[model samples]
Target: MKVSTHTCPVCGFDQLKEAPRSKSGSASFEICPACGFQFGVSDDDDGLTYDEWREDWITRGMEWSSRGIKTPRGWKPEALLKSVLKKKK
Candidate 1:
């Protein structure tokens, strides 16, 4: 049997890792260690582009924040770096 691998579109990295399966059994995501980009295992199933995905992810966080959920202070720097790099695109 042949094995398939997913590549990162942002940095052209071939070392993609599979994310844990969700309870819904929806399509799985492949994460790029180099650029921290994630997408569905199959392109056809992944309707959102990188930016779209990021926006949705951010919106989810915002929703949680609105509910008074607190985020860790240490994560702020990494989130800022990701945002800055995203704007460079």
Candidate 2:
């Protein structure tokens, strides 16, 4: 059987690791070590390019954070939005 390699769509990193399987034996996700991007079901079938992923990721992240979900690195939604906007400027 031929082995298939997975790459991070966001950072183009080939070093991807599989995440732990869910209890329900559902779909699995791959995590990119280089950029810490987790590729899930939506990402696989969303037909989003890297640029679109970046934009959508940030937007969804902010939306989740706004709902009181703790974001990575202790960043608030507003703070993360500011940082991204600053980089675009």
Candidate 3:
């Protein structure tokens, strides 16, 4: 698969301007619009593993997470999730 820098490592939403983690291993602190995973806050502060969050998000019905941002037309989370990097972290 062609990995993208803009892709969300957990949820495969590919619209981000930057990767979740930087080369220096700093979390971007950006919250994903698709799955609501805050790169730093969710992972570091909350102690929530990426895979655990993804699994729970999937179990709870994949819904658009961003409140201010409108969901894209024809949003299909399961389909987009196919591009997400699996539980490697």
Q: Which candidate is the best by TM-score?
A: 3
For all predicted structures, in order, the TM-scores are: 0.34, 0.31, 0.86
Looking at candidate 3, the ten consecutive residues that score lowest on lDDT are: 80-89
**How do the candidates rank by lDDT, highest first?**
3, 2, 1
Give candidate 2's error at residue 10 in angstroms.
1.0
The window of 10 residues in a row where model 2 has the poorest summed lDDT is 62-71
Which residue pairs collide, candidate 1?
A: none
TM-score order of candidates, best first?
3, 1, 2
Q: What's the lDDT for candidate 1?
A: 0.44
lDDT per residue for candidate 1 within 1-89, as digits (tens), equals: 85655444443333334432345655456554444444554233656565554455455452222123343444343344355456567
Alpha-carbon local distance difference test for all models: 0.44, 0.45, 0.86
Comparing 2 and 3 by TM-score, which wins? 3
State which candidate, 2 or 3, has the greater lDDT.
Answer: 3
lDDT of 3 by residue, 1-89 (tens): 95555878778888886789999999999999999999999999999997899999999898899998999998889877876654343
Worst lDDT 10-window in candidate 1? 62-71
Model 2 off-target regions past 4 Å?
1-4, 17-27, 41-49, 52-89
